[model samples]
Target: MRGLMSAGLLAMAFTLSGCGAQPESHEAHEAPEHGAAAEDYERGPHRGRMLRDGNFAIEVTIFEDGAEPEFRLYAYRDDKPIAPADVRIALELKRLGGEVDRFAFRPEGDVLRGNGIVREPHSFDVTVTASEGGRRHRWSYASYEGRTTIAAAAAAAGGVRSERAGPATIDERIDMSGRIEITPEGKAEVRAWYPGRVLAMRAQLGDRVAKGQALARVESSHSLQSYTIPAPIGGIIVEKNANVGAMTGDRPLFVVADPAMLHAEFFVYPRDAERIRVGQAVALRSLSGAARLQASVEAILPTADLASQTLLAHVHLPASAAEQFRPGMGVEGSFVVAVQPVPLAVRTRAIQRFRDFEVVYAKSGNSYEVRMLDIGRRTPEWTEILGGLKPGTEYVTDGAFLIRADIEKSGASHDH
Candidate 1:
């Protein structure tokens, strides 16, 4: 089953090569003929790779005019045209990772056409053989494209790194805005036990105090005896209503709030309120983004605000967060509403536009080539792959643009 899947993927990869605009030239490396300049080669009218061995020769070209790329070979004897039916040809292309693709030719019109399309990244070692008139001929050459080798040090200096493609979990989140506030139970009101005159105020506004600590000394009007009023809770003095000589009655003397016991109240509109629930995880960030923490929703207010008509989602913070966060500070939150598991995925940043396809640079040893993908679900961090890549393939996860630039800079063609 694995082998069949691999074969299908290979065929798909080859087919995809024809879907995009062809490059000017696909040949990267070419083997030089013995005792001759590589550029000084005999050309046939078809403008293909012309091979000659004395009286017998064949012109090899890839025909891709409004169709998939396929091999079209023309045969000649003593520089004269020969019937294509009289010749039989075969070709084997060994690719970068030792995968070999073989093609057999059959006569069509005046040319002998190969059965399979030649895939992209045309870098390969090609072996060609032909039989005619009961005589055999063979030749070999190197043709390469879209591949480059950089030293390990050079790759590292260029910030290129590779990782194997694998499964990943994508977090689907909802963005929310809210403000930090002291929890209802975290606030306390300090008042004199009876109607009394404030004798002396010991604590001032904004002062930090402990529970039972003296906040004011009050003299009762009935008993005419002075008594000390202590803080109802260990917290900061947010509101101070009493002075050194003011008379206390029904109003609170001081309002103490525990900044350490804080919660973010996120307003959720009617459209999104259905998706929110207690215990859902949330990632909280301060308005400046310098402070961040993770917390879970503790409750959702049943009633909506009269003015905004938005429900409130309360997420309590840990005591340690008090150092960086304060009540009334605005905060941004990402609520994790769902998680999707995908079998094969890649970093979204690794994908780049190549011709007409979205691709990532797949690395083998020091050589890198493009891998076109069929993408599914996508998030900011990951994109799920539906096809066009094999599992366990090592691909560039960072600095993929550098590889694309290098390939383009070389003027490597996508032609056959």
Candidate 2:
């Protein structure tokens, strides 16, 4: 491109046949020898003294093949390069044009732009300097390009190319990852517990039924006469509170849907619940169908159920698997209790229960050694070991029960 531009300029100067001789005008001079503009201009072609000149405003733009834009100056009649470091910059953008951002030059190759660098390209001006003896020449250019602002700035500095910055990152580590659902779980509606006519159902079943959706109509039965029953949960009603004139029973009249926001609920031990989160990734498996599912905890119910003696965990299913799941299904899963990946872990089945101890039959030196181990956070395929293990230790995962059966048979043979 530089050669092409230089050649074009020389050709145009050759065409001007009748032009009069002037010191600064093209008269009796040969085309500046290759690299003469840069190598000779600084030397005044002889005394080797750098002389300062007027601040000529120049606009620059850059085009990059694989990275951010680079800068080049096309500002002065005698084109000089502009650079980023030469001018002070301030951008009114969240990312673009910041000290560490990327941007595209506005409207030309001498412009700049990039992803981490631009909101939108705007016109900008800058002041630059070139070494001339003991003084400097300075100037500025407006940018409208989108990705390489720095490139343009550099171009305006010296009309020379600058190197590309390091590769940009994809930034895949999400600070948080979780699932969301339109519904929740185990919702009991505060509907009438006893037989009663609708005194007046004030809160409709689907009216975002609160913990207590009440009916206003008075009743004839003593139970009904005693008190009005409010709906227990806040949910869209799946059933009506009616049969207006019929003898209503104690059974739930308003089949208030306890929306099952979670695909499955697990009981997390108190010690485990303390480490669990509302949005931690979990791997769930259906005990019946052997389907593997990935999901997030929708919630950790506020308090443990006294009778059940367990903490309620609501798991929101992956959108991909929701179609095949329903409420009240049995599932087994591991909730990531920690963020950091631990070492020396294997599938939970790699170990077997030996009376009251956790033991793994490890193969070493041509013998099986029953190894006692400490357990940690467990995923469906891996269980982190807090003790008694190391990476690359050969241990059996599946067929453990079969191994035990074989050992028992051998003992019977010995007895025989």
Best by lDDT: 1
Best-performing candidate as measured by TM-score: 1
What are the TM-scores, per candidate, against the unseen true structure? 0.74, 0.29
- Candidate 1 RMSD computed on C-alpha atoms after optimal superposition onto the true structure: 8.8
**What is the per-residue lDDT of model 1 for residues 13-37, given as tens digits with 9 covering 90 to 100?**
0111111112112232343221122
lDDT of 1: 0.78
RMSD per candidate (Å) reads: 8.8, 28.0
For candidate 2, write residues 102-212 as lDDT tens digits.
333332343222223221122122223343334444432222111111122222232222121111211111122222223544345344555656555555546556665
Least lDDT summed over 10 consecutive residues: which range in candidate 1? 11-20
TM-score of 2: 0.29
Residue 231 displacement in candidate 1 (angstroms): 2.4
Q: Cα deviation in Å at residue 111, candidate 2?
A: 90
